[model samples]
Target: MITSTTGLYLTAFLVGLLGGVHCLSMCGGLVGSLTAGLDPRIRRDPWRMAPYQLLYNLARIAGYATAGALFGGLGALLLQLDAFQIMQRALYALAGVVMILLGLYLGGWWRLIAVVERAGAHLWRRIEPFGRRLLPVRTPLQAAALGYLWAWIPCGLVYSVLITAVSTGHPLDGALVMLAFGAGTLPNLLGIGLLAGAAARIAERVWVRQVAGLLVIGFGVHALWSLFG
Candidate 1:
């Protein structure tokens, strides 16, 4: 079970890493706005901008971990109910299916996940004002706040991973899963000079997304096979 859990963590990380293209597509404007808000002196100097970038991303990941814990606890509660106990395996199965759908979505083969994102839009509308207030960020704290707010944005990719987090049925495990995933995404969102540009270019290619989608699909298949094989 330990090994299996660890494998799930790895898969989560890869999903985040490989999902960079999607992230770029979804949040590219936000990332641009983040940098744009920085003082010109800091923006021009990589050293100065580093701390702001790091803090915001870290805070964003923290938001994900917090959400994971909430969903994980919800799963735990459902399992605790006598009538709902049987739903545990069903949740896992659903998670696997969601991953497969996420792969298809990432590969541009399907877009059903957009409906899930749209469902969250109303909540985002409420939270967006807080993020806007933090804009033109001068302090790391303000940037962090903005990043945390950004985490709640309607994102199908994030919701897909949250499905897997719910299947974990443990708060710590779910938080860990999201932490690993967030770490994997750190490289792309870090917005470093040349590397960020190169990553963006690479992620834009059709083949990269297809390859990533296939690998994610394989993970989902493996998960389902383990459950029923």
Candidate 2:
């Protein structure tokens, strides 16, 4: 489904890896919280728990695909509308700024990023309870569904990618781009969920977070420059 040039594919992969890194901190809690109910015996069994973790991640990826498809379709509809270019560029600029703010937040420069995320609070509240109901998820399918639903939680990283996807100007392409982005995170998420303590320790390091923030901010700046230059 991904047919981009080597460079674009590599870029998508790198972005996915970065997204995974961001999730290392934010998503670890969710994964831990979800897996907390497992029997000590089950938790100790890597073979059984591993499948659940993989399924949970796949579900989340599916969610990204769904979002990508929806946004891509929206972009397509917008393309047919009058003044779509102007609207698209406006969205590009806005998304870029949001990414910059997200980077700053990641860098520990501000705490207000939560406020931007809270804009989706109402929807999240509605969906979150449903996710909780799937708690102590035993089956891979259940874990996947929960993960998919959880993917919609307000995340600046995902939003940044969404903005990039929409700017591609084709709904199918947008969806594929997001899928590529999601694929990029597989390694990190898979590893972190399985090795919680180590992942958390690595993510908590100041230098690691700062480097990630800088990379995201650099991307945001580049996006802005591309739009206005």
Candidate 3:
């Protein structure tokens, strides 16, 4: 039998990979900006760039954990309400809609995702300053902290995962689910953060994000169907 811990680890790894692919578009630019001007020789040295990338991802993962904790707490309380099941189904439905919208946005069918992006603007504003302070980060710890903090930026993807957590019923379980989601994103992100130019070329293709969006939407639909059917 798969223990909860095993499940969490598996979920985290899968989600990290998928999330890494999904984040290619958003993260590519940031990684480039972070590592723009090093010497060609240094840039080519995986030894140097690897640590920076690792730190960046570590920070983002930390952010996901923090958000999971907060949301998990809320989910726990909400579970006490008599209408919890109804609310969960509603959240699942909303997540499906958001995933579809994200798919459209990824496919260039819609550009109005600014509305969703704006929702996290306030949090971003607060965190942006801290990221700036970590500029030219030379250590793994620094990269991790910055990435952890950066993860809180409001995102439709994160929002989708949040809803998934809430629906899990147990607050701790919900949090772990999101953590799994974050872990799923790591492989791609670690690659992109370390090798921005190459990763960007691949990720920037219109078809990739569209397909990822579709997969996410499918997950959302599956959740909803399982709930209501």
Cα error of candidate 2 at position 141, Å = 1.8
Runs off by more than 4 Å, candidate 2: 1-12
lDDT per residue for candidate 1 within 1-229, as digits (tens), equals 1136788688779878877667777776677778888899988888888888888888989988998888888777776788664576676677677778878887889988788789999999999999989888889999889888888888777876787777677898888888888887788788532144665677778998888788777767777887787
lDDT of 3 by residue, 130-182 (tens): 87787765566766766876787767777766765666667677667777877
Backbone clashes, candidate 3:
19
Cα-lDDT of candidate 2: 0.75
**lDDT values, one for every candidate:** 0.78, 0.75, 0.68
Tens-place lDDT digits, model 2, residues 1-229: 1224344345556666765657876687788866775667768877768888888888898888888878878888888889997877887787667777877777777756677777777888889989988887767778888889888887767777777677566777777777887888788777776776787787778787777777777767865787777
Candidate order (TM-score): 1, 2, 3
Model 1 clash tally, residue pairs: 0
Scored against the true structure, residue 9 in model 1 reaches a CA lDDT of 87
Better of 2 and 3 by lDDT: 2
Candidate 3 is scored at a TM of 0.84
